[model samples]
Structure formats: C-alpha cells, structure tokens
Target: AERVWYPLWDAGLKLGHQVGTVAQLLDVGAENLETATSLLAARVVAASSADGEALVDDLAERALAQWKGRSRQNLDQLQGAVAERHARFGEVAFLLEPDIKEARGGLRDVHSLFWVEQATVPILREAESAGLAAAFEMLLEVRVELHRLTGQRADKLLLELQDDVAAALGLADADVLMAEVSAAGRTIAWTGEGAARRTLRASRRRGPMKALSGIRRREVAPGLVLDDGRLELTDDADLGDPLLVLRYAASAARHDAYLQRGSLERLADHAEPLPVPWPAEARGLFVDLLAAGPAAIPVIEDLDQVGLFVLLVPEWEPCRSRPQRNAYHRFTVDRHLMEAAAEASRLVGQVERPDLLLVGALFHDIGKGYPGDHTVVGVDLLTTIAARMGYEGDDVDLLVAMVEHHLLLPDVATRRDLDDNGTIRQVADAVGGTVLLGLLGALTEADSIATGPSAWSNWKAGLVRELVERTSHVLGGGDVGDVVGGSFPDAAQQALLDDGTFVVRGEGLELTVVAADRPGTFAKVAGVLALNGADVLGASAHSEHGRALSVFRVGSVLGGEPDWARIDEQVNRALAGRLAVAARLGDRSRTYRPIHLTARPARPTMTVDNVSSATATVLEVTCPDGVGVLYRITRAFAELDLDIVRAHVQTLGSDVIDAFYVRDQFGAKITDPEHLAEVELSVLRWVAVDF
Candidate 1:
C-alpha cells in the first residue's frame, strides 16, 4: 500500500509543479471511487511544516480549471481516443457474454462522456447530456454491484453470473437486469457515437459557401431534401407531418445516405404521431425502408440513435442493443432484424406480396426478448402491430401466418422427405397457397443469412428451392406426376450438352456420352471413365427414346490424362457384358483409402423416392465422398437389375449428394415397400463397405 501511495504522490506533485499551479491536478477516478472494486484506497500525508488543508483546496480548483480551457488539439486527441476505444470494442451487442465495461454502449462509453465534459467539449447538447448522465449512473451502479458480487474487478456480465448479480441488485431476475443494462448501454453508445460524428463534422473546414460548392441540396421526397449527402427538411414542409420522419428515413435508405443530426433533433422535437390505424403512406414508407436492402441498415441505425425507431415501433425498446447470449447470432435482436429485412429486400421480387414479406422480415424475431418460443410470441406481437398499422382481413392473417411459420421452409427442406407426395401436400396445405409459400421461402433465406454463415449452404439452398417448387405445383392443383415428369437436368448442364456433339469441356475431364440407352448405360460409362484413370467428380445422366445423353465431370485418379479411345472401347465392352466393372473397381480400392472423410463423421443415409419421377424411383445417396464411391454405387444398381434413367451427382465439400433415377425391369416405378426397403439396404451396404 505504501509503495502504491508513494508513486501516486510523486506523480501528482510533478504534474502540479509542471502546470505551475496546485489547483491543476485532475483526478478522473474520484467520481466513481466509492464503487470501484480494484482501485487502491490511500491517503497522501503532507509535511507538518506546510499548510496541508489549504494546499489540497488549491489543487482542486486548479484541476477544474485545466478542464475549462482545453486547446483545439486536446479536443481532437480526446475524439481520437474515443474512436480508438470504439474500434477496440467492435460490435458487442450479440456477444454470448458481454464485457460490461469495454463493450460498445457500456460503462466505458458513459465514462467517455465524462472525459468530453471535463475537456469542456460541447459535442453533446443539453438533451443528449441529460440522457447520457442518467445512463452513466445506471451502468456505474451495475459495475459496482458486479464487482461486489465477484470480489474482484470483473466486468464481463457472463450468463451464469447474471442471475446472482441481479439478485444482489434487488432486481426480479436476470432478464429484468439485462433489460435495464441493455437500455443504458444503447443510450450511452448512441450518444457517444453521435458525439463522435459531431466532432468529425466540427473538425471539417467550416464555410457555408464551401459546403454549398461541394454538393447542392436536392429534394428527394415530398418533405425531404438531400443536403450535401445528408438528409434534411425542405423549406416547404409542414413540421407537424405525421409521416415526415418515416418518409425521410425511406428516402435516406433508398439513396444510401444519412439523416443530418440537426434534422434528427428537429424531427424528434416536432414530428407528430401517426393515427391509431396508420395511414397508407406511412405503411408504404415502412416497406420502402426495408426494400432498400443493405442500404437501409445505416438509415435504421440513425433512426435508432435519434430515438425515432422506438417512437415508430414502441415495442422495439426491450430488444435494442440487447445481447444475444448464443453462439449462432452475430448481432443483437434489433440488428439481426434489420439485417434480415435487408436480405429479404433482395428477394422481394420473388414474392407476390413483397410489402408483407418486408414487414414480416422486420419483425420475424421480435419475440426473442420475451419469454416462450420466439415464433409463437412473434406471431402474436407482429399481428397486433400489423393490425394497428391498418392491415386487415387477409393481409393481417398473412402477416400472422408469415411470422408463425417463418422457419417452415428451412426446417422442412433439411429434415423432412421432400420426394414424398404427402410431404409436398402437407407443406402446401400448411402455408395455404402459392403467395404465402413464396413469401415464406424468401423469409427463410433472409432469416438464415442473418443468423450466421453456418446456418446456410448451397446444398441447403438447393433443397429449399426444390421444396418450394414442388409445393407450388401442389398448390396449383397439379398431380404429383406433372411435377415428377417435368424434372430435367440443370439448365446450365443441358446447355453444355447442346453446344457440342461429344465435347469434354472442364479441366476435370467433362465427357459428353451420347449413345443408345441400354440396361447398364450409366454403370458402363461410369466404370469406363474410372478405368481410364479419370476419377468421376460428378455426373448428370438423361435418357429419352432409347437414346442417352450423359455428362461426367472427372479428375485424374492416376495423375495422368485419361485414355479416351480405351474408355470408349471399355464402355462398349461393359455394355456388351465383356467387361466387369465390380471386379476392376474392387482391385483399385486396395491401393487407396477415402481421402475426403469429414473431420466429424456422420452416418451415411440412402433415401429412395417413388413420387419424384413418373418412370423411375429416385435414389439420393449422401455420404463421405472418396475415390470410386460412384462406381461402387452404380455397380450395386446394376447388380439389382435397376436401369439408370437419370442421375444428378454433386459434390459439396467433403460430402457427395448423388441422385440416381432408376427403373426396374419393364421400366416401371418401384412402389412396393419391401422392394424399396431392399434397394435402400443394398445401397447402404455398398456405401458402407470399402469395395
């Protein structure tokens, strides 16, 4: 303790003498010292010969004076420091456990205001200052309580400790404590960020003529004008316009610009509230803001900073700046909603009611802050809000349905059997019609993208699109056969076939095989390609009227160019029963092991579908992709006397998703449950064994 006091005393004395006054000693830590857990408590004793009490009193006055006449450079230095701290914190609202001191909009932001005030910087005006001071006090109390509970200088409000801290603070529970903390954090962060913006604005060269010369003001909407890239009020606008704020927000979003701070302050002061059932223009503007895609994020942030978002959607308060204590999210509930809306905006053209999709996206997860399953809670909350916004009858129902079943598409696509007629019918019936199906499909993508990268993949996207298309057919009152019979090769791959008679395009050896359809066409072609030292990466096979057009994308297994002439001869021999694919592949298997096994293994699944095609049973085999896996599966089909009609093979990273459409003898769909089970079992055995 004495060692600590000696250094502080020496530092204070040196700083006091250098400033040439005892009153110039500034103590930034004193204001919150009583609540500080880690700061050492010490007293500086003076010599018995000196006037100790008088010297202390003089030091306080000089310290206050040093803050009063700060130079321009000093103010800039403070701004830079705050900006550096802001960068260090990054976006923390959605961190699984947030640091209560250094996180954005946390105690540090509140402390920055004290520094700003101490420097006599007038960046924060009267209203912002009042708000910030109250927020600072709240955060300071939380920090003090946290330190007391932990018995250390702990600042991270981790999930496990939140309940304990809440109990110590006399709060009802952790949720209530978190709500209060989030509110304070949002206020402090928003205020500090506004001040930082203003400081940058203040540092710019100031001259009305020079500002005007850069970019003149232009009217963007009825009551809004773009004043040098920032939005502001036009001279002819009515100050009391109920829709004025929303209109300006929409215009700013559309142009990828921001609302001027002065304009925001003016709007906050005078903008009138919309009627109970919001007018057409207000609702339209809300949709427009969402439709602006990524451009809307900054505009929404500006609205939130200026308190306009809460005014527009009063229910937004509990969620604003709220931390999501989960690994899946990368943003707070409010930020995630904005990002979802932006992503939905990109897919708006896909839906019939883009406006409803936009609104639904904006409020999809509004119930995360409340208790219960978010989907159920969100449906009730968004329905009420939609009703208040003047949506009625089918429109109100549509919004409710959208919220309730937002996760329907992705869930069904990934987990359920998409090739079953019953599966497609069930989804179609649940979502009502094509309109809702389209909207739900778009919302699913938007929501997943906002959740995080791990929540989506190309394979997932392909699955969802297939579900949507099949469901659309059902809703259109078409039989399963229409959907099944119409399924064709991917348009891009079909184009690749028509461009040349027998072309091999890709570096990975794409071979276009055009031949008369036979009993083991796919097996022969695949085995020939394999024997020629060409490893099949993927293949697409299509057949019509005794003729087959197949494309195989292959890489070199032997690290050399494939012998095309030998491949042609072997394919013919295999078709003629003069070549054995199974025996040759079995020999090759002994030399190499599977290379692309997942770091975390998953059980291989073989799905047999009879409803996806009119003439063939669809077999989708998903497994760890490795050398000769395709050859083994094709050989198994040939041994089962199954004729391959079409095959779509795709490799996604370490896994292979290969769909083989096959017909039994007499070219009929295999509907017998026992036979289908046998086929699945056979494929599983082939996929499981090495050879």
Candidate 2:
C-alpha cells in the first residue's frame, strides 16, 4: 500500500501541506498534485471505493488529462521513480529464487506499467496488455499461495519453499513451477521495459513543426534506417524478404540503437521465413548480428520480445525464459547463450575460425532445455542448426563437436593433472586438432564467464591455457616431453636453482623461495604464507642437484595486499626451523574460517595416478577449501618421505583441487598398492584437519 499512499503524501508535502488526512490530499485534485502521485491516488481510491466507483473514474480521467497537459515535466519524475524502484529490486527475470513482489517482471512491474500508461499515452498493444495481465495474475496467485503456506508475508520465492508452493498450487514439481514463473516474469519485465523506453522517448520529442523539420533519417542498410536515433524500416523497404530480419537486427546492433517497436511488429508479422540451408548472404547477416559484441544482446532481446528471433531459430523457443536451477548460472538458458556469444565475440581474434567460434558459442548450451544430457542433446541440436545455417559438412561437424566438448577444457583443466602426459594426450585426442582446440579453448573461457562470477578465475584460466598449449603441441605431432620439459626450472627459475643459496624474494602477490633441498621445505613455505595472510592461489616446485626453487602466486586472505616484507623474513626463519610453522598454522586455522562455508562440504577424495606421468606419481587431492589446505597436504607428503616434484593448486568456490607430482626418496613413482593406499589415507587425514 506504500506504493499508493507514499507518493500522495510526498506530493502533498511538496504543495506545502502536512497531509495529516487523506481527505485533504484527495481534495487537492489533479492540477496541484504530481502526475505520478495523482495516478497512484486514483488507483488506491478506485480499489477501495464500493459505491463511489463512478466518482473514482472521474478522478482518474482528470489525472490523465492533467498529466497530458504537462507531459514533459511529469515524464522525467515518473521515469526516475521507475528507475529507483528497479534499483531497489533487481531486474533479472530468471533468478534461481525470485522476488515475487519487487523484482523486475514481478507484481510491482505490472503496477509500473499501469502508472506509466496513466501518465503518458497507451504504450502496450491490446495483445500485450492481455499477456501482461495474465502474467500479473499468475505472479499474484503464487504470492498469495506463498503467504498462505508460510503464514507470513514473504515475497522471495525461496528454492526450498518452491516445492511446497508448487504442491499447493497443484503444479507437478518445483522445476515446472519455476519455469512457469520465469515465463510470466519475463513477459511482464520485457513489456514494462519497452513501455518505459517508449514513454521516455515520447517525452523527449519536439513540437510537430520542429520535429518534422529536424527529423534525421540515415540509411544503415538496405532495409534499415536510423530514424531519429531508433532503427526502423524505411517506407520503401521490403517486408517479405527472408534475410531482411537479420539485416535489420544487425544494423540495429551495429548502430547501437533501439529497434522501433512499430517496425519490429511489422517485421514479426510480415517477414518471410528464412529458407532451410539458408543462402550465404542470410547466414552472413545472422553471423554479423551475433558478431556485434555486447551491443547484440539488447537487439537480440528486442527481437525475442516480438517473436522475430524465434522465427529465425525455432530451436531457441524451448530455451527462452528457462531457469537454470543452480547457483553456478546467473542467467536463464537463453540469456546465458546470448551472454556467452557476446563474450565470445571479444575473443574472436584469438581463433583461426572466428565465424565457427561465434556460432558455436551461441548454440553451445542450446540443449539445456531438452530432457537428455545437455552436451549430448546440444550436439544433436547444433548439427541441424549449423546445417540449416548453410555450413558445409566439415563446418557442421566442427560446430557439433564444439557443443559436445564445450565444457571439456574447464572440466579437465580444473579437475585433472596438466603435468601428466596421458592427460595431455587424452585431451588432444578428444579435441582432434588445434583448430577445434582453439575454438573450444575460447568457448570454455566465454562460457565460464557467462555462467557466473564464481565460475571463472585467473587460476582456472591459467590451467586452461596450459592445457591448450600442451594439447596443441601434441596435436601438432610434437612429443609430449617437448612441452612438459619446457615447464619447471624455466630460465628465471633455473637461475634461482643454480644459485644454490637460501633466497626468499617477494614482489606484489608473487613469492619465490629457493632453499637447500630438504624434506618439508615446500610445506614450511606454504604454512608461513598462510600464517602471513597469504592465500596460495597456485604454486610450482622444481629442484636440480641440492637446490630447490618454489614459486607461489598468492592473494591476501583479509583483503588488500599481503605484507611481503614480513612474509619474506618469516619464510627464511621457518626454513631454518626457528618459526614453528605447523604450530603457528594450527593456531591461525582455529581462528580463521573460510567466509563461504557450504552446507555440504565435498567429501575428501584422493587419487594416485601413475600412468598419467612417466617419472612421478600424480597424486590429486580434492577437499573443501579451507585455511592452509595446501600447507597441510604438502606436510603429509613430507612426513611420508615423498618429494613433491611439481604441484598444481586451484580453488573452485568452496572446494580445492590440488594435483601434486611426487616421487619416493629414490625418485621413483610410488607403485606399490599399499604405498598408494597409504598416500591417499595420509592426505585425506591432513585435509580433514582444517574441516
């Protein structure tokens, strides 16, 4: 009810009145009150009146007339109110859990439409109004049911409560309930946004004579023209041309302008269907639209709202407004695809086939809406889509492969050992060649970025990049050692190893430790860094003769930069057995807890892989990420008399995946079954200490 009375009170106070009573405010009439306030008061009075409906109707008409009399002055305030409301409540339509009352596309958006309509001219078409009304009713029903079930006024449709809400409403399950909610919210949000833009544009227009004289129309393409800053079709443009829709969309994106709603409606109603196995020109235009980078997203969204986008790719309908019921994805299936394509456009220069990369990114996750495995289903779906878009046999196959292997890079990079020859060979075989590898590599980065903030990180990017380089070497017929040999003891590190002296160098977030090769050297450095408030993002170790060199990439656990001078001194003292590294780390672990502790911690697991690497046993440990995880794990290996040749440390959200290439005291892989089992048990025991 605040939406109704707050504006009225604010307006009355502006008119130099206390507004102590509703009667005083209503008696002020439309002339003295702001248009937005008058409209809000009209709705409240009309809803509350029983027998005075006719009187309320007269009040509403007077408010509309007054608003029209000073449309320009009123429009700015109304638009500002709408923007402020959106700021308070987010505008995303397909959140895993949605706010039913305040979120964009929620009941408040419907109310915003009503306010905008009363303040300006009619913005929604008759059909659009009907759709918006239905959407509002659905959201209202859900909100009412939520209130009844919870016995309290709760607006957010929480994930855990969705099932109970769905059952009360006689829906099949939570997914079904959420999908319907997404559809309704998207409709209301899109309609509301369009209406707001149109009203704002109308308010900015000049008087008829000045407007006609100053109107600027510049042709952007064959059918599209920039008419008064909006992309629209010229009077002589052809409507029946199949490729015209793509051309218009591309021009709109390239010009960075909003597509005129009237022109969009005309195109949706009259444009012919693109022929199957589309001609080169039509395909080129479609690609060009996708290649417009971030600008293409809003243009594609506008086309989707009018049903024009679906006409080009019918497979896109199922994905539209479909919620991804997980914390990892920040957008709906269709929106994520669009975002991924937009991100991929920026990385086009990195690949040999930018066209395939762009198209592949757009369709990579298209099968999430289907029932089967998304990757498998996506491969099938893209096969048909690629062929229809006029790709040749090999191009179609490559696109299909891209969807099938879209997640391959990130999954392998984060979860497997990149130092292993077998791992590199496996990836090279799956990717087939460098060209597809390049495409998938870029797609992996784009897709992860689009998923959510937690999905992509510099550590993950490094792993993927390393994997791609190693796989590229193998695919190009180079020996695996050619790539692996170049790693570790690189020119800078080899110089540190050759020094054969204790050296602790600290620069920014990177720390390098060179010391005499000894048991627990790596563990001491890791524990010292952790105690110094340095979160070890990644670390690598190498040794030649009696000297060992370790390079660590770290970030501050408490934010800002780490105290490098203190860390450097502490590392030297710990290596000299004077700093009590383990005891200090244990104390810090008791005091410091990870900020993002999940309800269900991942069950710790360890795998001893001997076949992946020829010389060292690849021991991979996965556990919930906590304080000093790498320190504790390496300490266990040192206790077992194992020497860590190399290590890859990565943190993915609440979990950490650490792969260590280790060897026995004699520099031999731990091949005995009992020894392997002991290694797994020891690491798991140490990792569990922090948990």
RMSD of each: 11.1, 5.8
Highest lDDT model number: 2
lDDT of 1 by residue, 1-691 (tens): 4654568676543211122234222443223221111112112355344576566555544544544444344556656665676677653355545677888888776666665555545778777788878877877888888778876677787666778878988998876676667767777777777776665555453434455443666777777887656778776777788888888889898888777777788888887668889999889989888889999988888788777888888878777876564455667788899999999988988989999999999998998867899888888898889988889999999989988898888866764446556567778879988889999999999998897775676767988999899889878988865564334456765664455444333333666676666656777777677656676654556655556677776665567657776777776677678888777776776665544422233368888776544556778888776666777688778667787765666554456677777788677888888988888888878877766
- Candidate 2: residue 300 Cα off by (Å): 2.3
Instruction: Please tell me which predicted candidate would have the highest TM-score against the true structure.
Output: 2
lDDT of each: 0.71, 0.81
- Tell me how candidate 1 scores on lDDT: 0.71
Q: What lDDT score is found at residue 124 in candidate 2? A: 90
Please give the distance, in angstroms, between residue 632's alpha carbon in candidate 1 and its true position after superposition: 31
User: Candidate 1 — which residues are off by over 4 angstroms?
Assistant: 5-84, 117-120, 205-225, 234-237, 260-262, 301-311, 314-324, 369-373, 477-691
| Cα-based lDDT at residue 611, candidate 2 | 73
Model 2, range 499-569, lDDT digits (tens) per residue?
A: 67778998878888998889999999999888887878777777778788888888765667788889888
- TM-scores of all models? 0.61, 0.79
* Clash totals in order: 4, 0
Total colliding residue pairs, candidate 1: 4
Q: Report the poorest 10 consecutive residues by lDDT, candidate 1.
A: 33-42
